[model samples]
Each structure stands twice: as structure tokens, then as C-alpha cells.
Target: MKKIMLIATLLSILVEGYAQEKCDTVFVRASTENGIIEGFEKAGVRIFRGIPYAQPPVGELRWREPQPVKNWGGVKKTVQFGPRAMQLPVFSDMRFRSNGMSEDCLYLNVWTPSKNYREKLPVLVYFYGGGFIAGDGSEYRYDGESMARQGIIAVTINYRLGIFGFFSHPELTRESPHRASGNYGLLDQAAALQWVKRNIARFGGDPGKITIGGESAGSFSVSAQMASPLSRHLIAGAIGESGSLLGFREMLSLAEAENRGLLFQKAVGAGNLNDLRTLPADRLLKMTQRKDVPSFGVIVDGYFFPEKPETIFSKGKQAHVPLLVGWNSMEGHYKALLGNEEVTVENYEKAVRQRYPDIAEGLLKVYKANSDEEVAQVATDLAGDMFIGYGTWNWSDIHAQTGDKKVYRYYFVHPRPGYKNAKTGDDPLIKGAVHSAEIEYVLGNLPVNDVYDWQSEDYFVSTLSQLFFAHFIKKGNPNGFGVPVWLPVRPNQPADVMIIGSNTRLQKEQHRDRYLYLRNVHF
Candidate 1:
């Protein structure tokens, strides 16, 4: 009888301990292709952070393509963010809650509002933009919790950056089974998408309904991924915010890229690929910061790109999925026009004539400015084109003309409310939406960034934009109930992009002549 009483007492202790533990923490879980991962719950969302999507690219793997993640035996606790890719903190606005930086950074995070494995939500995987030099998926401005609440699964991923990601070398290419060296970053992105395809279904994400989107380099990456044969089947639709390697930038050939790699090796006094690979990751990161360092950005590596990006797009060889792309109003500010010259009609004209000496007369027709005010406006417009407008426009135009599906284009014109310049200590009287200003708003994350004195109007703008984007993710079209009617860019009618700003409407594309001039005559 005493022994039976003791057993009852032990059972009571076990029950009490279990109750206490359950109250202390809540655990949510997902079974991935690699392993079961446990996450924590917050705000009606189950968030899994720092899930490794690729084998760490260290030692002999630095310049190689990303390999598959290894299967784990037990449930991996993915409650904390992983180390960010090796990079310098270039943007003051970028913040992180990750452990720190390292080369083992091919990690992706997810946010899901699914109650069980039976629910399948549309997935939106966003890549951060940082000129391919620096960025973290853990930035507060890109939090996916709110997006999950909207009944969509959100994902953010990290890839190798800068030289560590884009470097090309003759020795490295020879060592590659695919005879490719550069574009490791692009390959990393493709691997991440492949991971999404094979593993996201377990997290209540629809593997067939994944939409890839980003701003700046991330936009460039989306374009690259769409162009690459490796990532074609993984994408359902695409959203490019404001840049592509082919849109406004030059891409080095494999040979040129290898030469640049050679120059970097010479400057750094590395004898060979073996020597370079042995150097500390920080050492390589520091070399990328040098102004004189040859930057071999996106290249036509034989493995990643079967052909040039433009050639692929021109022949309708890219992914035939629906595309939604756009840029800000003032992609390049007035300062980009003035440069060293004073803001005068005479100086502006002189600069224009110098830039377009061969066609100065014809160029002035499109960029006509008789007064100083007119000059600033014209200069601002041209600078915007030179920065990102023309390239993004070129992408949308080509895709609309060639792709199997219709294309949706937009021009974001909402300027950030003028606030005291954080650096100058006075209001700069900001008047235009410069590059990357729409990211937070479109992602439904305006509250995450308080750098500007956002008004109710700003929130209104955010709500409408997010709705449009969410609709696009859920359905192929951004048009839906209670939003402004949006029409696709027709094959014949090139203009008619949706204008999203203080007053949202469908405005006919105005500077058609100027864009044509820039496309054909100017640059």
C-alpha cells in the first residue's frame, strides 16, 4: 500500500512539471525535406528563422555552387536567426537581430499563419537589396509576421555577396565540373528557390504558387533567376521593384570576369585560387571595400546563363511567367544631375551637350528646358532614367511584348514626408520618391520604419499598395475589389502603368518620347 502511494505521488509530480513547462513556452513545428524544425509563435504566426537551405560554403566550397543541406536526425530549433553573409555595414538604416556574421550564411526564414499542415498559403520569397555587397534578411523593415497574418506565407533568404559570391577565376572555372566560376551568388539564389520547391510544402506553403520579388539588387536577382534555366520551373510569378543587371547595368563576359578576378588576385598579392581561398573571410570582405577593386558583377557564366541576359529576354527565352515591375519617381535625385556644376540652365545644357555631343541637337528635343526650373525638371527626369527608370521600363516593355502572359507595370511616386535630414540636421524639402523608398510600404511594414514622420496618408498608401501586392501574390493580377482598376500593358499599347501615390490612378505613360530618345538616341 505504501509503494502504491509513492507511485501516485510521482505521477502527480510528473503532471505538475509538464503543466509548468507547457505554460512557460509554446512550440510550433514544421517538417522540412532536411529535417523537422521547431519554431516559436508570435502574433498568430508561426515564425521559423535561420533555417539552413544549403551546405555551408566554406574551405574548398567558397567559389563553388551551393550544395544540398544535410538531413538531420532530430528537430532543429530554428527560433533564432543565423549569421548573416560576410559583409560590411554599408547602410546605416540596416539593422539585425542575428547572432553575427559568417560565411555559413545560406539561411532562409519563414512566416506562416497556417493552423495545420492541411492549409496551403501562397508564398512570397523576398531577397534583400544591397548592391550585391551588403544586406541581411533579418532587417526589421522586412519582417514577415504581418504578411503571414494576411493569410500568406512569407520567406526571406540570404546569398553570398560581392567577390565571395561573384568572383571568377581561370583556375576556379577549370576546377568546376560545369566550367563556371563567377555567379556563385546567382547560383546560391537558384539553390534557395530549389529549396523552396522541395521543402516549403511542409510549412503550409503552396510550392506551385511561389512568387519571387525584391528591390534593387534583389530585383536584379529576380530577373537573373528568371533568365537562368536553373530556376525556371521554381517561379510562378515575379515582382521586380527597381533594377536588373540588363535593365541599366553592364555585365562582364566570363573572360572579362576572369580577368577582373586575376587583377583582384594581383592587387591582393594572392598567388593562386588556393592562396585566395585560404585567406580569412574578413580579409576577403575588406578587399571588396577598396574603391579601386575591380567589381565583376553579374556575369554570363556558362552554367547559370545559357546566353546573355538581354539575348535571353529578347528571344522570349526567359521564364514565361507573369511579371510585375516598376521603379520610383526620382530614382536619381537632383544632385545626380548637378554633380559638380551649379544648378543652372547653362551648366545643365553644357552637361547635356557634352554627354550627347554627337546627337546634342536631337537630344535637346526630348530634354528641352528653356528656364532654370525646366532644366531641373528635365535634368531630374533624365537622371531618373539614367539611374533606373529606363532599365526597368525596358524590362517591362520587353516582357510584355514577348512573354506568354500579360505584364503589370507601376510607377511609385509617393515621396517620403519631409523630415529633418538625419545628417544635415534640417529638412531637405524632399519632394520625390527616390530609389528603394517603396519597399517597406509595399511589404506592409511601414510601422517598422519610423525614420520618417509618416502620416495617415502614408498608412493609406501602404494599405493600398500592400493590398495590390497581396492580390498579385494570391492571384496573378493586382486588380481586385475596392482597389483602383489596373490594366496590363498591352502588346501594342506600351504605356498605361498604374500610378500609386497620394492619388492613386491609372495614368498614361507620359514621357514616351523621352524614354524612346533615351533608349535609342541617348544611352
Candidate 2:
């Protein structure tokens, strides 16, 4: 009887302990000033997917500032991804895939690891990149699980894309308080950040420690946000890859965006905003293919984006914060698809001479090569330099020269062995260390496990990189375990930069002469 009683007690204790072990999932109720939203949890991380930061920009709300979501009665299921913003057909192999996308896709996703009533982890809010036309956060690649696992609450967001997201018209302006228009996508991003500031704490995220980052157009949005005083307190720092806030004056101010909207109206033959809203989401997405104009992006609106990004940064009015910036070796590695027969040495020299009359000779001398492929690679490198590299240096230079903030720059040259196309031979014919390649590494998604497997190198690179980033987010300096004593980028120490690659070495005076030559070139 005694033995039986003890066994029974043990069984009961085990059962109770099992019962007490709550599923790692967390749930939170977001109390925005607009309404209350209930978000579920996944493995101790609270996730709110497709939560509307603003009113559905449907019907008369289209092309207008994002309004607050109306109050809800009970818990709203945020399991599935929200509709994607209007976008052009992104995939090239369209023959195999249908463009099943939509326009009413202004939504955001958040992931946090804490469930305590008061614990607030730092937030990492991201914007996806697609040249203002293609990407959405729904890609299988950008899952924030690893980032959240590292204790940084992660948020991935989708904003308006293409013409639907960017179109600005005279009539549209007349309807606005700022009397200016363009870049509804930027406004959408801002709305999402505002939502983070208001409700992130409920998910155990520190609103004050939020870091804004993105790839291409997403990077442009970061620059725009940096320039906007409205977004000052919402973001702490920024990370931009292969995109900068230098050009777009002509594109943003042009009537192309408005014209594209007019085209959408003509396609549906919608009489007004209400009519446009009534059109089916599918039809709107299909109509987004009308023409590739300056349809989406932040404009030089005197209201939100009062001045050009370069002008803003030049005056040192950009958000005073630390930054981490980098670019791939071959940003235009996709040029093979362009099949340019003019990618010859003489042609490139002539082209450089014409485009950069002031420093063409210098550029040609540095990138002088023997073959078309080499010249093509040089051209891609030069383009990357002009678009991303120079901007990165200038950004670091500006901050180091003015603000008390720190700036860290990197060059991602870790080209995986098997990553080279088998058909391309010793030369990297495809996008070698191309744009967005650093993403997989930084996320630790590679599958190599041994010395022979290239993944070991990738693993170390990613681990150290993650540590650097995490350290920066947590304590402002990107120096900690496994990172080679990273120093601040100052005018006196501008030469030192963290080179993230196979060896992960620290170098000085890297790309100085290259960027110096590009300084005189026109965009």
C-alpha cells in the first residue's frame, strides 16, 4: 500500500509538471490608440502577422495617408500573411508561375521572444527590397525565427510597390494637406514603425531600441525615414545594403506615378477613388503591369520628405544614429541577362569617359581590363561603387565627421565555392557574392558541416557578423565575443573597416581610391 501510494504520488507529480510546462508560444493583445488586436505566439515568440497598421487603403482611402485600423471585437487570427502591396511581375520565368498578387497589401509582421508583462527586448524592424517593384516579406528566405531566437524581436513589413505604391498626381496632390504627393510606400513603412512604437512593448520589444533595416527600395525607405523628422524617435539606427538616398529627384517629382494611377483607373475604367477601390484585388495587381515608370517611391514632397536625401545628410539633419552599411562585389551581376554586346574594353572606356568626363580617365585606368567579361565585371563593380559603396563611405564619413554616433562598414566578398555556376568555370559568371547574398549567411541558414563543406567558413562569418550586429544593437559598439576588435569609423580612423568574408579580416584604406574616383561621376 505504501509503495503504491508513492508510485501514485510520483505519477501525479510528473503529470502536474507536464501540465505546468506551458507551450513556448506567447500571445499578446496590441492596444493601439486606434484599437485592440490579439496576436498569437510561436515557440516563446509572440508573432503578429498581417496586422493592419492602418485602415485598409481601399475605396476612397486609396493613395491617401494611412488611417488607423477600426476597432475590433475579439481576437483576430494573424497566422497567414497579409495581402502584398500592388507590384509588377517580379519573376522572370513567368511561363511557369502566375502573378497571383494583390494591391491592398499594406500589412506588417512582428516576432518577439518574451512573454513577461514587462520584459522588453530590442526590436529589429525590416523592410523588404525589390527595386520598389518586386519583393514582399512573405519570401521563405526572410524568416525572422533565428533573429528572434537571438533575443532581438524581429519585424518584417510589406509596403506599397511599383506604380500603385508610388503614383502621385495633380488631383491627388490637390486632395492632400501637404499639397505634395508620391511615396505612399514610405508612409506605409512609417505607419508600421509607429505601430511598433505603440504596441511592441506588449510583445516584449523595446520600442526605443528599434533598428530599421532593408535591402534595395527598402534601403531607400530607410533613407527617407532617416530624413523625416516624424520618424526620428521611432528608429535608433539603420542598416542599408546596395541602395542609397542619393538620386530619384527626377523620378519622384515626375507625373509618371500619377500617370500610372491614371492608367490603373483607365484599365478598370474606375471613375474615382471609390470606383478604384471597388475593383477586384486581382485586377488591380494585373493592371500594375501597365508600364514601368517612376510609379512607386518617396517623393521630394515638402511635407514628409522635405528635401533630397543627400541634401538632408549633407546638412547633418538625418537621424543622428550609428549605421552598418555594405555592398556586394558585383551588384549588377545580373547583366548577363542584359546580354550587352558593348561590354568591351574600348566601349567601357568610352562609356566611362562620356559618363564621367571629369574622372573618366582615372576610372578607366583603375578598372582597365583585357576581356569583355572583365570589363563587364568592372562596370558592375563601378555601378555598385557609385550606387552603394560611395554612399556608404559618405554616410560613415558624415556621421564620423559630425555626430557622436559610430559608423561601421563592411565588404562582403565571401563567395561560396559551390555558389559559382558550374557552367561559368573559374570565373564567376553569375551573381557572385551578388546583391542580397549576405542575407543567408547573416541568418545562419547554410547547411555545410565540415572543413570540406564551405559552410564552416560561412558559419564562422555569420556567427561573428551576428555577434557584431547584436553587440551594436545592444550596446552601440560592434565589439564582443568572436569579433576582431572592431573600431569606430572616424575621420582619423576612416581606413579601418570590418571585411566580412572567408577570413573576416580588418583592413584599412580599402576602396578609398575607388570611391574617390567615383566622387566626380554623375549618377
Candidate 3:
């Protein structure tokens, strides 16, 4: 009888533990100011979704900065993803699956590795890329489980995008403390990071060891955060992929960005901000599809950000932190589709003269192509180099020159698994590691049906790359178990940029010589 009682007690305790473990599998509710948030967990990760970081930016809050998340009552359901921010239709059936769109979209997602409730692991927060208009953290590709399993607490957030995220008008500016105009999305990012600082510890994450990272627009945000006083002390290090400090011109201020917004309003026949706001959510989304211009994205408000990110860094006004930055070798996949009909010598020369008049003559000599296709490739590669590669290189160069913190650079050259099916528009030839191609490698969650082969060189490169990133997040150095020695970048001596590929090698002139002609043009 005694033995049976002991066995019964043990069984009961095991059953209770199992039930507690299953909490992560089902809809787990979390309490927040806005309400109860429910989230799902899997593979040793606790994922909370659709949790409000701030009050819904609706009605009076439109075009205004994100407001504080008000207090909530009972356990909130965060299991389902919240509505996506207003965006144009890229996917056809984008309803609840992609369809449900809302202006009240200020929610964020969090992924914690374990429920130990005391681990306090380093936190890595990601911002998605959409040219400041087209991305969400909830995208399936951005699921942070893989990253979280690597022992870092990962969080992906949704900020306002397009006009919803970046609308700036004179009226909106007058009501501000900074008198700042534009960059409300940035404000949202700051708010999310602040939320992480305040609450991540509850999820077994260290607020002090937080690292901010992103690709493209997200990378742009990382650069901006490095310079913003409002963002100081919120971040430790950074991992920027394919975007850099040199791209500040891409960010516009309230007046400038809103002028474009006004133009868009006129084109769309909306008289003023109120009308623009009142337009049906679908219409607003449709307007974003116009491709003419959109009223969104980060801007260079003197208050929130500077006219030049480099200028701030040079003046020692930027945050002093280690940086890991890189860009893809074939970044022209999208742009080449739009331009470059034929890669003929004449066409290439003409294209160069038009796009880069100052360096056309010089670039023509270095990038000689007998066939139109080759010329197109050269031009596309050059564009990739200028926009993505240049920014990355310059960020490392400039940072190495000033701060004591180490800087590292990389060039992503891993090919995807199935390139044949993924052809786009005019440029149909296999796009050797294209822009945004490295996303899967970084996140370790490539879509099974993705065009490029993940099992090829990308598999090797990505493993190392992600491991390096994990190391950087945990410790300051990017080296870890069985990894190759990553060289630190210095201002002098070719910068020792790490070429992340199947076969990693250090190359001094990864694309430097090709871009030499543009030196006088001032990148």
C-alpha cells in the first residue's frame, strides 16, 4: 500500500509538470497594458504574438508617435498573429492569411528559448525590411525559433510601414517635443526596444546585453539607432546586413517625406490628411501598390536622426559598439529586372552614363562584356556593390577609424537550392546569391519550396554565419565552437572583409576596384 501511494504521488507530479509544459504548445496568455496576450511555444521556445507594444495608433493617433500601451486585465491571448500593418498586396489572398489589415497594428512578437524563468540570456531584437513600407515581423520567414534555440532570446516587432508608418505633416510636427517630423516607425522601434528593456527579463533575457539587428530597411534602422540619443543604452552591439550609415539620404524628414505624401494624396485624389486617414483600409493598401511613390519610410529629422549617419559617427556622437555587417554578391536581382533590357556594350555604357555619369567612362573600361547578358550582370553587380556593399564597407572603415570597438564585414555569396524556378521579370539567368538571399541563412528557416538550394554552399555558410551571429550576441566576438577565425576589420590595410560563402576566404578587393571609378561621385 505504501509503495502504491508513492507511485501515485510521483505520477501526479509528472502529470502536473506535463500540463505546465503543454502551456507553451497551446495558447499561452500574457498580461500587458493593452490586454491579455496569448502566444504559442514549440521546441523549447516560448513565442508570444500580437502583443501590443503601444496603444493602437488609430484615429487621433494617426500620423502621431506611438502612444504608451495602457494597462490590461486578465490573461491576454497572444496565440494568433495580430493584423498586419497597412501594405499593398504582394500576395493575392493576403487576408487573415494576408488579408486582414488594420491601422491599429502596433503589436510585436517575442521568442524566448526556455521557461526556466531565470536564464537571463542575451536578447536579439530584429526589425524587418520593406523599404520602410512593406514588411512585417510576423512573416513566416522571420519566425525566431531557430535563433532562439541558439540560446538567445529573440524578438521580432511590427512597426508602422508605408504612409502609415512614416507620414509627416506640418501639423503633426507642431505638436511634437523634439519638433521633429517623420520617423514614427523609428519611434515605434525605440518603444519596442524600451519594452524589451523593461520586460525581457521576465522571459529569461538580459536587457543590458541586447543587440539590435536587421537587413535593408531594418539595417537602416540599426544605423539610425546607433546615432539617436533616444536609442542610446538600449542596444549593445549591431548586426547589419546589406544596409549602412551611408544610406541616410534614403531617409527623409517630415516636410520632405510629407511633400511626397501630399503629392501621393493629390494623385490619389485625397484632399487632406483626414481624408487620407478616413480612406478604407483596402484603398490605402491599393494606393501603396501604385509604384509611383508611397508616403512612408524613415526620414532625416534633425531631432531624431542626422542628415548624415557618418557625420554623427565621425563626430563621436554615435554609439560606440561592435558591428557585424555584410551584403550579398548579387544584390541586383530586383533592380536588374526593372532596367537592363540587354547587356550590350552600348546599352551598358548608355545605362552607366545615365545612372553614373561621372564614373561611366571608368566603369566601362573595367567591366567589359561582349554579350548583353554579361553586361547586364556587370551593371547589376555594380549597383549591388554601390548600394549594399559600399555602405557595409564604409561602415566598417569609418567605425574602425574612430572607436575602440571591433568591426567585422562580410560578403554573402552562397547560392540558393533551386534558382531555376525563381526567375523574375527580364533578368532570368540564375541570380548568384541575390539580395535578401542570405535571410534564411541568418534565420535558419528557409522555405522548403524556396528557389535557391539551401542545402548547397548556403548551408555551410549560413551555419557559420548564424553561429557567428549567435556568438556575437552572447559574447562580443563572433568566433565559437569549430568556427573559422574571423578577422577584425581595421581602417587601414584593405579592411580584411570576411567573405561568407561555401568556402570562406578573405579578399581585399571584394568589389572595391569596380567601385573605384565612383570615388569622386561621393558615395
Give the Cα lDDT of each candidate.
0.86, 0.69, 0.74
- TM-score per prediction, in order, is 0.92, 0.82, 0.85
* Candidate 1 TM-score to native: 0.92
Ranking by TM-score: 1, 3, 2
The candidate that wins on lDDT is 1
Relative to the unseen true structure, what is the C-alpha lDDT of residue 461 in candidate 3, on a scale of 0 to 100? 75
Ranking by lDDT: 1, 3, 2
Give the deviation of candidate 1 from the true structure as CA RMSD.
7.5
Instruction: Using TM-score, give the best candidate's number.
Output: 1
Model 3 scores a TM of 0.85
Model 3 alpha-carbon miss at residue 512, Å? 2.9
Candidate 3 residues 159-249, lDDT tens each?
Answer: 8877777777665677777786677888899999888888887778888899999988888888888888889568889988888756414
Off by over 4 Å in 2: 1-40, 92-100, 247-251, 254-281, 291-296, 334-347, 351-359, 365-377, 416-432, 447-454
lDDT digits (tens) for residues 1-523 of candidate 2: 9999999999999888877665534556655555566777666666667777788776777778887777776667676678776666675411111123566677778777776737778878888777777777765545676777788888888777765666677678788886866677788888889988988887777888888887766766777788787785688888776577754234354355566556656665678755655667667667655554223555666667777667777788888888876667766542432246456777777777766787777877766667876776677777666556666666566656665677777777776545332442434453456667676566544542121235467678778877777777666667888678876676645457778886787788555766655554534
